[model samples]
Target: MTEIELNNEYFEWMCQLVCNERYSRRLSYQKLLRHLHNIDFQYMLPMDGNRAEDGIDLRYRFGYEKEYEGSTIASYLDNSPCSVLEMLIALAFRCEEHIMTDPDIGNRMGQWFWNMIVSLGLGSMSDSRFDAAYTDDVISRFMNRKYKRNGEGGLFTVERCKYDMRTVEIWWQMNWYLDSIL
Candidate 1:
């Protein structure tokens, strides 16, 4: 029996979270993940400090709850490239799946994830039309907080936001997004 590589396992897990039997777009997600991984290596050091915390949170999640390779996210990081954008996407998936559990809502897999991608103006980025330069531009805009005050280019867009999203952390932005949608 061939053993599955941990990085492959993790990527498959991430892919599964957003692409399931009910809603599957495995190839597109893989492309996006690859894109994020490649770009993340360059910006691993947080532009600000908040994303570092988000990366830590994601590391802990993979280490403790999931027990990927006996609770050591460092190994994963060393073995595979993961970015704050990827972590944020994973967190959003977890929130949509676990925290906001409302069966009545019929939340399909990748629903929230795609919502965020679209909100970031990255919905058009697909395997067929994948543009590395454009993707990098969008990611740079997000990391540099070039998004509008209302979060237009960021993960969440709250038109009537109480906080300036450009200056807010992603966690708060996600919260406001979840709040706004409801």
Candidate 2:
């Protein structure tokens, strides 16, 4: 299949899994595993086999390992250029309230979201320095403090606080641009 087709399939699969009622609880990880099984996606059980615990799993089923080529979820998120934006859009849609309230993960998600835009060659909509500026702006807005320059000649400036909506707008516009393209 084409890359776009593959990405779309994966995206739909993830959306269905997340939206299922049985898989939508706080103890949802097990539900996710069960959903994966229902969809014929193999997964590795946690080495300890204690499904109640919270941590990474090391013992994956052969099918699951082979399908993903041993890449961790984070690595797949970082490298999958074609579907990264859609994945982020899905995540943002699902976690809208949490994103607005939790600055740390939201900022990181914003950065990754913008980075995906850059990787897709959509950087021309804004200045070349947009990503760094956008990240700094996000930090300042969420922390609710002004940034202070560390040194007169340094390229880096330190933010004393979190970020706000204006900072988020920069990244939002980028996402909007991407949606238009897609």
- Name the best candidate (by TM-score): 1
Which stretches of model 1 miss by more than 4 angstroms? 1-4, 21-27, 41-68, 71-73, 76-82, 97-99, 106-109
What RMSD, rounded to one decimal, does every model reach?
4.1, 16.9
Model 2: per-residue Cα lDDT over 26-47, one tens digit each: 3223232222222211113232
Residue-pair clashes per prediction, in order, are 0, 12
- Write down the TM-score of every candidate: 0.74, 0.21
**Candidate 1 C-alpha error for residue 16, in Å:** 1.8
In the range 58-162, model 1's lDDT, one tens digit per residue, is 545555656655434565544444474555555565666666767897765377777778888887777777888888888888877788899998778888898
For candidate 2, the TM-score is: 0.21
Per-candidate local distance difference test: 0.65, 0.31
Model 2 spans > 4 angstroms off? 1-5, 22-66, 70-163, 168-182
Q: For model 2, where is the 10-residue window of minimal lDDT?
A: 150-159
TM-score of 1: 0.74
